[model samples]
Target: MYGHGYTQPVKPPPPAGLLVLLRVLFLGIAVFSIGFMAWAPLLRLAIVTRKSLDWGLFVAAMAADVLSIVLLGSEPGEDVRTAGGYLGITLLLGTLAVGSVYYLAADIRHFHQLRYPAYPVGQPRAAAYGYPQAPTPVPAPYTAPNPRQTPPPMPRTPAPQPPANTPPPRPPQRPAPARIDQVRAELDELSDYLRKHDEGGR
Candidate 1:
């Protein structure tokens, strides 16, 4: 009456190691994008020198690729063999990974070089985009204070009136006293019968 039947299905086999490696390499590239193009200043710095943040990212990608290869090769029930397929995947993903990093770094540098700040301190007012803006006009200097004139009073809302004199609803009535007494007597009779039956059986 209290059993729950639950079953766990078997997992499907993973793709070939080479295919898995390629996927991992793509994931690495995606992860590196966070620090590369996403942060333009770092990309620009990397562009100036071949060894910038991108180098660190590139190293991390290569390490991940090697680790993935080792893990996939050793995992049980995998079907990887021979050198051709292995070498092919490594070379393809490696080339793509490096090229993608360089391409993204270059794009970031281009954007940084082209982009200019809208507001620059110590610059000419007319050339600045959001600087100083036009000053609002002021009312002619306040004439001598007029004590007699007062500001208009604010208006207030009145509270709502309640419904005319109605009594609250009453609660439901309980069962009759005679009915309660009858139920108590039946319970006592059942208790006496059980006691006698239990003693006689013993």
Candidate 2:
């Protein structure tokens, strides 16, 4: 989007019939200054008849006018009176050339504006040139996916078991010591064997 500061070149209105007539008069003077050059006369004729000037003819005419000026200015030395007359003629031709150039430039600008006018910023340019305005494209609306088209569900993970539900580990057991009764029984047997030996000796 362009800001309010943006501006378009406003085309000047077309020249009226009187203005066109004046242009023709100036163009004729230019053509005369160029010694009635062929292309200049043809271009002038086209203008008078309300026809577009041919690009080739326009170029040729301008070239001929420039050549004419160069040739006239490059003449050999002459008397003071002749030089004065040449200077006056040169000035007149120069004026005519300037006028003709301005007139052609205006005409070309007008034609271009007619064919392709500048519209204001943010405005439709095709409308200015008498073309139909094109429709603005709209994006399509979004929609939710159908249940039948949905993807399969992912596999579920198992939950971890709580510590309280697990069994406790048992403590390590030590080996049992010898019994006192067994020790006493061994001592009694030894005493009995000694007594029987003593009796046998007596």
Candidate 3:
């Protein structure tokens, strides 16, 4: 789901170690070519007897060497022993190194192209390397409901009504207060009894 938008099947990349090895190999080849070219006689011999080695490899190496020389030749100098030699050697080496880097990048791109060509439009890419290919689901076709045969409506429940003779609910009543006059009469009776008892004793 994270990369759902990437409908194109992910192309497995070349092994990292393999790629790194290839880059190093190319650089080594480029260096060997530069060294071979530095001495003009050997380069001439190689060109003359190209059939002695793998024709493709020899030609590519030669081309790389010549191109580096050409790039170096652009710099102004007097003689090979002076600034000319230094500049030429420096430029030639730099050109070869840069070319090697470029070649490495190009070779990687070429490998990718060979491995993964453009996927055809509309056709989903085949799932490989543990990736699951989910099929696009088709939706069901729509149909109108039958006009003559409709489902019966649900029954409705009526609310309950109170009886007409039922009395209305009354408010709660408060407790009655104690009578002050009754309390005073009790206190006076108690005092009179006590007073008569005390007088009889004396």
**Per-model tally of clashing residue pairs:** 0, 0, 0
Error of 1 at 113 (Å): 1.9
Cα deviation of 64, candidate 2, in Å:
22
Ranked by TM-score from best down, the candidates are: 3, 2, 1
User: If scored against the real structure, what TM-score would every candidate get?
Assistant: 0.23, 0.26, 0.30
Better model by lDDT: candidate 1 vs candidate 3: 3
Candidate 3 residue 45 C-alpha distance from true site, Å? 23
Better of 1 and 2 by lDDT: 2
Off by over 4 Å in 2: 1-29, 33-83, 120-202
The residue-by-residue lDDT of candidate 1 on 1-202, one tens digit each, is 5544555863433345643464345445445643222223223334444665566655555555555456446545456464644663454455445646564555445344444335354443453433566544444665786789896798989898667896766899999999999999999999999999999999
**Tens-digit lDDT track for model 3 on 142-168?**
888898987899898988877889987
What is candidate 2's lDDT per residue for 50-80, written digit by digit as tens?
5454454556556655665565556655432
